[model samples]
Target: MNEPMDMEAVLERLKEKGLRLTPQRVEVITLLYQLSHPTAEQVYSLMSKKFPYVSQTTVYSTLKMLKDLGLVNELTYGDRSSHFELTQEEHAHFNCKSCGEIYDVDVKDAHQLQYMLHAEQGYQVDFVRLEFYGTCPACAAGGKSEADAGRTKQ
Candidate 1:
């Protein structure tokens, strides 16, 4: 993972976009900054604990505004719920099937791929998202144990 973002810088950027600094917006951005990629519901649940007055609609609208302002990125893994994360240096995502943990993966040749696509296909790619799905280390090891136990039973 890359270094944590400076909240002050993010706030300054938001100001430059002519967005007023509200408590709910600050809470949502802070949570996004801390947690890599969290669903809108996840963000609402966390914020509701401290700021119970904030509603889900407020969170959703705030996220949409932030995305439009280029402060946050909306991500999906073909799941029922969409996820949100603070925009950082472009990278890929790894979804663990067992643990349900989302991890960030840096793609070194992303620019090269973009260039090739534009040159060969005459395509203009503004952004790219790559996702890999698999069992993580803990889940893989646990699955092996289960398989071994099933063999013993047989």
Candidate 2:
């Protein structure tokens, strides 16, 4: 499981980036801190409950800014819409086909693989993304098969 995000650090980073600490931006960031693998629309929907006037554009722009700042990551799996998560230590992702849930997974020797690729293949690795797709524990317990991987959220 991922640790809770440090809101103070996020605010400090925003200040360092010379960005204003607007209410909308704060709400969006707070949502990112709380949600795991939420899409842009999901963020907007939750934020709208508090600030009913909040626009989807605001969510998208805030997410884009955070992505540009390397504070968040957007993931797209199978045929689902993109999901957002806070940038953290190197890790992989597991997508549950039956429930459409995204889970964080620890990757072993991830850095070694990057180093090996750089030393042996002459490739300068920027970052690595490893994703696994299959039925989750609950799905498996329910006797769901990999063919049910077609289930996905927009």
Candidates in order have lDDT scores of: 0.77, 0.82
Model 2 regions lying over 4 Å from their true place: 1-5, 78-80, 143-154
Q: Give the per-residue lDDT digits (tens) of candidate 2, residues 1-154.
A: 4553588988899999899999999999888877767889888988899999999998999999999988888887656789888888878888886777787878787779999999999999998998888878868798655444332332
- Scanning candidate 1 in windows of ten residues, the lowest lDDT window is 145-154
What are the clashing pairs of model 1? Answer: none
Error of 2 at 147 (Å): 19
Q: Which stretches of candidate 1 lie over 4 Å from their true place?
A: 1-5, 142-154
Model 2 worst lDDT run, 10 consecutive residues: 145-154
Best by lDDT: 2
lDDT of 2 at 135: 76
Best-fitting candidate, measured by TM-score? 2
TM-scores of all predicted structures: 0.81, 0.82
Instruction: Put down candidate 1 lDDT per residue, 52-90, tens digits, no spaces.
Output: 888999999999998897778888655566878777888
